[model samples]
Target: MELGVGWTLKPVGFEDEEDGQDAKKIVDNQFEKMDYHGTIMELGMFYRVLGRACQVNTYDLNGDFYFNKNEKVTGADSINPMTITDASLRKVMADRTGTEPYVQRVTGSVGNPGTVELEQDRVIYITNNPFAKYSTYGNSDLNNSVTDLRTLARFPHYRDALARLYSQMHRIVTIDSENSYNIIW
Candidate 1:
């Protein structure tokens, strides 16, 4: 299957001149015209965590969580747990030549807003209020007014994936002292 679009792999620090030369060749040969397929994958993680925040804000705006409210409210609710069967997150690995199956979804609230507990298998995709603004009310009043606004937390697996991607990017560009380097595959 087509694993989305390709990404440009830029070379960084290299100890050997030959490694730098190789990296330039690789860029010219493969990655020069590649596209990273938008930031959707990254946003996916953000969306899952902040979905509840959206719901909560919707409720505040519409009075009811389902309707559109007048106030600048923010929050979210459980809209059924997200599931990732086999082959959920498929993509071209950082090696730029291989494909890999990665975790797409995680159970439970990737982020939550309310202090009330959530149900099992029913994860809160969005839990924080990103729209919380300053009010003229006193600190205590402001605290109470904006008590619901919170930042969504990231999923552990998603966090891991981000870290791995960063590491891979860093690894691919490293140059050896011998001036010869192997492209990570």
Candidate 2:
């Protein structure tokens, strides 16, 4: 682990980031891992700010009202949530502006802990697997389409705050300066 014969060896015991954890654990681990010497009031405030950030910016770039939105993102909590019949759904996801670039840009990026379930298709199903409960998936446009646009209002936000929270967490971790600590607020 040489660094051009200059800097000392990088610190060991870096935290392994996990997804879909309970809020208490998330905040506790986040605080502990940051090596912060703050009061619970400060920690609570941080959580509040982070929570609000997730809620507000979650839909910041949500683009449009379409027939099929909140597309079920499979393979999250299941081994094989997507059947072969839904292969086309994966492609449709890839074709979408919201998900396509994320897949491509993050495809081989090292230490990238994010996940995208579909590789291709354009269908929406309300049926939720443990992993893709929030995603839309199916093989037919009719099955995917609906009259209420708001129900399908996920647009670019994936219909929830998880994505925004993840992005915000990345910011907090990467730029944890004394001043940066309050950036989320």
Candidate 3:
């Protein structure tokens, strides 16, 4: 995407410059530890191809749901978009909060499947189709080309068959040649 070469942290209005520098140092350290550049690049690839991407956050061994702006974040790992079954968004006006912001994924084989529900704070989710309000999953960038891709895939076989059909030679022999041979004999 090349939105920016690298990340920068600038002090907000009325914030101390030195404090901003310190915060930047801490963030840079975490970025290095988490391989943020590489992970983001990978996520971008998935987002382009599959129309959605996600990275699950890893926290310290203390406990689950330790998501804060401090040292709670240990690392981040990317998840395959295909394995993600569903994603729910937060409801602002619902009384019961219909569904929490979470992502459900399937793991293991079909014979022995496992479901994992990752809370919203633990995931960095990106989608190509963010305008769809009620949809759970993002639409693929390749969705429009699916039929064209299928035709492209079968083009080689069809072209080869047509070539073989047109390559055959049809020869016509006249009975006059046989009669001429007999007259010569």
Candidate 4:
């Protein structure tokens, strides 16, 4: 089954540009901005799931108290940094015949391998299960569900939240960078 993840950002306040001189200061400030934004997005996703299961406010869904004051307001504290040590993406894969499930595979090819290439550098297949089949009714229901969810999750809310959180980070960059700041989920 596919899992749902949701995310949001918190408001961030930064010092004025007049107090800038050192490159270290600028880099540090930028890093702080990234950490804050990343954390909030992560925490928001976590809270979305927890709030649904426990029927509580998203803000109050933090069970480990990882989001106390002094912790980065962003959701980074919700996850263990070590879990994402490598830049590679991670996912779960289930075993079809056996009860044992395993983490998904990670592989990349040096060049294009056509339909019948056998001597590939890296070949990884984490599962043997066939893809899930969807009936026409199921497909329609899924489409409607997605449409309803997206409608409920207004784009303006995410935009406004991010705008408020990284107001200073946004100012430091150019218009092109600002355009790039737009994140969907």
Off-target runs (Cα >4 Å) in candidate 4 are 1-17, 20-34, 52-76, 80-185
User: Best candidate, TM-score-wise?
Assistant: 3
Tens digits of per-residue lDDT for model 3, 1-185: 24113344555663688887888788787677676777677777787788777788867688532344365343676667676654243341121543354545564655667777776667676677768643445777678657655765878656565546535633444334324533211
Better TM-score candidate (2, 4): 4
Ranking by lDDT: 3, 1, 4, 2
Candidate 3 structure, TM-score to reference: 0.53
Worst 10 residues of 2 by lDDT: 51-60
Off by over 4 Å in 2: 1-76, 79-87, 99-185
Q: Per-model C-alpha lDDT, please?
A: 0.33, 0.31, 0.60, 0.32
Task: State how far residue 77 of model 3 sits from its true place (Å).
Answer: 2.4
Q: What does candidate 1's lDDT look like per residue over 1-185, in tens digits?
A: 11122234446799887898898786554322221132223333334442311111122344533322243221232222133222321231122433333232434456633223322222222322445331111122234323223221334445565556546654443434356765654
TM-score of each: 0.19, 0.14, 0.53, 0.19
lDDT for model 1, on a 0 to 1 scale? 0.33
Query: What is candidate 2's lDDT per residue for 1-185, written digit by digit as tens?
Result: 11111111223354542332344465455434432223223323322332210001011135421221244211111112223224433544345454532122122347765444432222222332335533434232233234323454656455455445545545432334334444443
Q: How accurate locally is residue 90 in candidate 2, as Cα lDDT from 0 to 100? A: 51
TM-score of 4: 0.19
Question: When superposed on Cα atoms, how far off is each prediction in RMSD?
Answer: 21.6, 21.1, 21.0, 19.1
The 10 consecutive residues of candidate 3 with the worst lDDT sum are: 86-95
| lDDT of model 4, residue 27 | 49
lDDT over C-alpha atoms for residue 38 of model 4: 49
